[model samples]
Target chain A: MKRFTRSLGLTACAFLALCGQTQAADDIPTIRVGWSIPAEEMKYWMMRRPDAFPDLGKQYRIAWTQFQGTAPMVQAMLSDAIDCSSQAPLSLGQGAASGGLQAYVLAQHVGERKGESFSVYWAVAEDSPVRSVADLKGRTVGVNVYGSGVYGQMAMILKQNGLDPERDIRLVETGFPGSEAALRAGRVDAAVMNQPFALRAESKGGIRKLFSLTDLMPNTVHIFEVCRKDFTDAHPELVKRYVKDLRTAMALAREDRAETLKVVSEVTRAPVDLLDGYLLTDKDFARSADARPDFEAIQQMLDQYQQLGMLPAKVDVAQFRRDDLIQ
Target chain B: MSAQAILQRLGAPLTVLVLLTLWELAARALALDGFPTATESLAQLPAILFDGQSLQSIGASLARMFAGIGLALLVAVPAGLAMGRNPTLARMLNPLLSAAYPVPKAALMPMVMLWFGVGDLSKILVIFLGVSLPLLYHSYHGAARLDDKLLWSAAAMGMRAPARLLRITLPGALPEVLLGCRVGLAMALIVMISSEMIARQSGAGDLLFNALDMALYPDVYAMIVILAALGFALDWAFEHLRLRLVHWAEPRQDAASGGNS
Candidate 1:
């Protein structure tokens, strides 16, 4: 009887020790970050490097998560499953305004540049007679998602060409990689594509560029990094460290083409040649690593979305910016 | 076979052909770019079926569907049997089952992904959830509604409990179980396709979705055709299997409709 009692006591003590250990582990400052696939999110690639962001890792354990698109990523943020994520500006704004998610834009991940650099392109089959946006009347076009940045750009472009996006033509939602095949097969008159898919499709040589994001709205922000407002308020230091780590990684990626290509190739599983064609140039990096959100550009997107009835009302772009965290 | 009987058998095929003709005419008349005529979609089917990528996608989707339905059967059948036999177990599970039955399985997808990751396991779980409820309900009803005369006869014959359950109760329940399996199988395919479209790296759903993204309208139609053929073939196979296993049971009128009794 005494032996059984002693064993039970010992088991109880051991269970308590385990509980305490778990509590300590839980207290170790962890942040879950979400990213979309195919776009080659820089922080995820940088995290692969053993020597990169040493201090950040030491300060906090980074839990990285992958998502298929901005909508899912935004869903994760709303559910408190992820503290931060990268999303298209239109997605972030629409999600914030509609879902009532307290999210702040931290930095621009991809944006439009004048004639030198741009991320999104509208492309059609080379054999097709459709020369311009005017030719797209009563035809089908493709976007990655209905409420995504690509869709916004397509809508804006259609409007610019005196076409109503709703009644003028049909817009189908297609993934970036799939858009290339659809364009080739004549499934759509044009597909709204983003880098490195646009670059890859161009290299294949049967698709013609119908228009670019810059063609419609020059020097605009397309995609940006965002974090939940409550998370930033509660863990300001961790958020700052994350931003610092990201900036350092972006700078490193910009300076070392070979290293960046190696990491991107590893993450995306694309060939080095494709990565070289897409990433190894000043013009490419210019659009990719802009560390600050252009408020004017963001406002332009907001106004455009509102005008198109995509957003319920105009949201103040400045209110969503977290320049302090980025700095 | 009599001439009238043969003509009656051709009704389904004739209706299908008529629908296809209408569809082809409508597509041509509308002249909608990217909307393929039935002929265009059918012509592309051979190439799509032969493509390595498409074949792999079909295989992956089928594998997930079978695995999910198999898993659902493994758990649901036994649990359902136990619940139907014991009033206490039925009371415990019926409320919970009914509560969950009406909830959209897709809504649970995000939570499932959080738990299982965006992999085959998550998609399988979604399909499993979708299939298991109808299976459980059918199984419970099958066991619970067993003829009292048969049970009384088995008891009077001095047959043991296990033997009676195996020989009489289970065989009697086979028709309902098979009916549940058929419904579950169809649900499994639908849930699998939706989950794949949302969370997949590859599958028939991904193939269809990607094809649409690239604006490959004929490929999209071809995928739809393949999915329809797959569902029809599987349903036919299940019906044959059911007729074989439950040969003693009265032929159900609703069997042709594939509808629940």
Candidate 2:
């Protein structure tokens, strides 16, 4: 009877030891993510909520930082201040072509589709005489920035309409909110707007959409998730887990609209009505949260940028894409 | 001028040249990818200067800067003079000025835009707000602290208040007022550039920002050079005007120092 008791005690001790080992293995470090204030990248914001992805919080802590644009985001990623971020294809291409950054695609932020996707719009005052892209000649136009995705789309659309982006129209770099203000004030003939701002401008009833990016280039990839090559190499499993958590958050957002809207309103500090105007349609959620990198679309964007003389040389899109991470 | 004076005059330009040379060398040694060498930027200068759009941008920026400073002077000089001559006005305005001086003028940009709309007026008002404070302060002190002996003599000579102000007070205060104008001019340029960068369809700041966004490093550097040259030329012109206007006042050793000296 004494031997039986000793054997039971040893079994209990072994079980406790196994439990402690498992707990130690489950411990997760904090991951820093840089994002902008846009609905497309709000998945990261939603994941921060307690009920959004409980398992994600259990596995890892997230630290979120907001940046104004992808240029500064690239700077942060290069300096190792951020583990990952969302970047426009033009910015990613510029960084890669300049040899300043090497990053792997993790997911898509916005995708282009025929007659469905909402990307960027060229807008004018409601009473303006400008009706089409051809009317842009001798008129001042506004872009978020010159090397940004909006600027690239503006150039492409103007070029397609037989207008030279450089000579035919005066392209001024007016920021997003400022662009709308500039348009209303008659400062610029047209201003490029995206996402919530585009919808907000439309609902405000003063600005008219001159054209959209979809009108010129269909099936174009607008923005993507990127992590430094070194970060991915060091924390391969962490990257996978982060992508999985992001995917889960995306799914939850689509599955539960009311909760997603509440989170979006809180994260953006925008009014619910404005968000409703922005989120009323699936076409508004044209941003794909897919983990797999869209290689064909990315290649097409790279080719366009190369043709525009924005990239120094053509880059191999495959070299920057890591499909295995998502797999 | 003596050879030492010549060397002293050349000191600033020489320092700039050395720094630029070091920048070029460092860029080459480090193989900096996006940054352009000083020489490369210099090579792009003619292109920028010859570009019609760039020239128009420079003109627009200069015009805005001058217009802002001009408006500030129109209001601040008279108000400062009145406050200096009248203690009642001084007591009323002094607290307001003291309170508003420390507030960053850039923080008022959104409010100014809402009031004035996002046109040249908003930018001009921002510059005006930034510059008027320094000008008002200096002008008030300049006119307030007139030599009592000069005023007494003018009064004794039967000079009325208007003539006394015209001859004695104005001449006595010219030096300080010119100093204010010089400082205000610099402030106006700085504010103009910053406001233009924030919201503008055309200006040197806008050109610089657009170039940076396009990754035109050489063009960006070239724009900086142009802006620096423009600022220097304006400062030199103001200094010349100050010397000519306030010839009786003792010249300070440092030409670049502001009104506090």
Candidate 3:
């Protein structure tokens, strides 16, 4: 009888301890963050540098999810699988236009800054006779995706060079990994590339740049941070902390090049020497210091997509513009 | 076993060796940095297997795949058997199956993910969807081709409808059902890899694409080799089990030679 009573008392204590741990874990809310690329997203940096994001595991915990592209992120947000994510301007506009998901821009991550080297470059075989964008007529050009900012830039550049983008040149879909090889193998006459690919291709000594994203639109906002409006409304404090952490990450990348490159190398699994030449430097894509969204630049991108007939209808940027959460 | 049997047993390994030789030759001739040679690719295998994260990804992928196919077999076999026995049921479900046949299961990831979230449930559901159709199609034909007289004899005896199905119809359809399972096994692996590639959360497919994204050419080819070897091993094991289960049935032509009904 004495042994049975003692065993019951021990079981009760164990149960209470388990319940307390469960309640404590439940108390700390998780912010499900989504990112497509490694170096391009803040999550990769935030993961390695915990000191920069002091509130990360304290006020809120981060649950990281990697996506194939920003387009899939729209659906993920619609399902509430991701509370916040990195977004391209085109995806954000489409998500808002679809009416099922309401995502608000929190800050800009990648944009064109004046006097800095452009991140995206259109390159062709160095030995080829095609020296200019005009020479790309009747030839095939490879872009990452059909309705991406890169494709839009290519179309606008072709138009600027007096060639019909649709009727004159053939556009093929190629991913960044295969784009350089495709260009080299004569599968694509020209390939649009950004950092790593562009840098690697240049180092290979056979690819020449024709034009860049900066040459077409100097101040266009390429990628930015976004959160669901409902999520922001529900947990405004967590959102604010997240935005603050993002700015801190950006500042860390800008101020400390060597440390940033180490973290990037760990995340991207690319050699530090290969990335040292461009990543987070003046040659890299510009990030906003204050985590502010450039509404005008975003509007310009939306207008460009609309003019290209990529977007069916005009999206008013005002509806999705919310930067109040950024400290 | 005779010499002929020994030679037949050695055929698959010999074919793999020839293919690898050709790949090595072509890779050397092309001299493309993107395409790594077979030896270089195979060298990366030890690292993948030894790494904790890669092993976890592979383990999770296999678990989901097995779960998906197990669920598929449970539901699809019964429905297909019923449809085969009843002309009216077959007529009702044929249109739906036909409409879904041509649609790529991987393309349904976005819709499935929207409803189920990007979790194990969504991945398993997509694989289930992919494996089900092939199983249903084959199992239906298997049951349909059963000898009516055998079923009739069992029914004429003291057997009920369910008992006749169990004793007579099931045995008669065993060969066809096993063939369906073979096809469904391939579909399960296909859907599992492609779905993981699309979702990019965690899996062998994600591991493969992550290598591609990082420009780890050798790692990418290594992953392909691993997946290919995995597929080949699975098919070989299943074929052994199938032969044991349906040893009485006459040998069918090779699956690659379009022997499938």
Candidate 4:
């Protein structure tokens, strides 16, 4: 039996090797890019814009994957399925610790200091008499899945509002659109959300923002671009091109609001006017040079999160943030 | 039937009412954030019924779920029968099965994405992989449980080797096979959601994830309710088909007939 199994294994390995060799001939040092949002978002925003994604268009055929959240997108990069994807601050912190992947976060938000406040907002039904966080005690507050931006932001928001999340509000892991509906239906008291859903709720008089997490945790890193260490090592030039394209796209988005809004609205399926008012005008990502928060601050917050028994299976998150990507 | 009997006859609807009542109490008492009270969902059911995108998402999930289950059934039942009939082959594959017995089927999803790309194939394969196990095991055991006397009797009666094997062995195994089918059906729905939750950009799972992203608790519950219904409906269809075909073989059997469960 052992001999038979051994023979079978050898045959399978040899066949795989031969197939891989044939396929490798076509590999051409390809780079795969995973995106949390659809890739269409980038193309629509950049195609006509100046120098944005030109490098991307030239050398790399970005394989845009719409991951549910940043958690597994980081996992995918860590596992070597792709070169880069969206990274969560907490997940990035954990990923950096174990030293498997070097990842970094550049501010991925569309920063709009003047336009609209697209930074995270928490809200409930407009008619609900819950005026302050104190009234939210023992009420259900909705968030996206655990360990996600929504979860962390909501927790932080609650804490800042003088409401201890662990003590006062029962945060439920309700999805975003569902959370909006729940608020409308008077199911949840509040939810931590981003545009245009928040704007949608507010516009309909369906919901109202009680507080913004942005106000609570200023410079609280929302999202970042995470990359693999090995990929960066093998093709530094390609990674550079990827970042350059992202920056260029971000720059064009800042320079050309009208065009950017049209494209973004098409890509995200958000109405142009709503997106113009909320997303394009409100939250624009500024290019952080190092593409990361300081290691100590990042580490400290994550450690606090871990100590709170929020993290499962500790990781070397520091190592996951490849400084070279930002450098 | 009398009025009391008619009301009693409306038992299925009554069960649904009890379920709704339970859901409402739980949602309110628990102060469920982002989850709809049962009555609210019922009130908003019209929006779901009228919405094109919701229907499309539901349809997309159903297609992936059914296609995956169908593929699994096609492969597992026959292979299981083959293994069941051939003891030598079954023993030879035992180690292969046991090697990865405890590994979470969902963990291999990234590998599936690498191999299949982030397309329908990855989701389908995930569902297929999840459903295949109990099926292969149960059906193999079912085949083995067949009466050796029946096999000998058919052989003695001068039935052709293939015909004797097929007619006696397969029917004897059908009940166990149907049980495997039930297990596989339930598993397919679960893994389909999980796989879609992981890499899929559309489908009911994706819809649910999107709702979560937007913190739309009501839509999330709506999608979940839709998912649960899909599972129940699939299970019922399988049960119905199984009962129609195999109930005759139950104890006190006096006649041989071909029927759907």
TM-score for candidate 4, please give it.
0.63
lDDT tens readout by residue for model 1, B57-170: 789888988888999999897777767777899999999999999987867888887677666788888988999999999989998998878888989989988787778877
lDDT of 1 by residue, A1-327 (tens): 999999999999999999998887777797787765444446745567847777654678777655557788777777676788888766777778888878878866666677677557888888888898988999999887777666877788888899888899987877675777677767888987766667767766978888877776777775678889999999889888777777777677777779877887555434577668767463362445547777788888888888888888888887787777866
lDDT of 2 by residue, A170-261 (tens): 87888775666678767899988866666656766877888887786677776678888998888888888888877776666666677777
Clashes of each: 5, 0, 0, 56
What TM-score do all the candidates reach, one by one? 0.66, 0.52, 0.90, 0.63
Model 3: per-residue lDDT, tens digit, A1-327?
999999999999999999999899889988888876645646667877876777888788988777888888888998888898888888887777764568778877778787774557788898888898899889999998887877887788888899999999998998777889899889999988877777778777888888887787778787788999999999888888888888888878778888888887766556688778888777778776675888888888888888888777898888776656754
Instruction: Write one digit per residue (lDDT tens) for candidate 2, span B75-154.
Output: 88778876777789999999999999998787786567546644578788898898899889887898899877888887
C-alpha RMSD values across all candidates: 9.4, 23.3, 4.1, 10.1
- CAPRI quality of model 4: acceptable
User: What is residue A3's positional error in candidate 3, in angstroms?
Assistant: 1.8
| Superior by DockQ: candidate 2 or candidate 4 | 4
Ranking of candidates on TM-score, top first: 3, 1, 4, 2
**Docking level of model 1:** incorrect
lDDT of 3 by residue, B184-206 (tens): 89889889998876565668976
Candidate 4 lDDT, A175-288, residue by residue in tens: 655566666666678876665566665666666768765564445455656567667777777777776666666666657768777776444434466556554443433334
TM-score of 1: 0.66
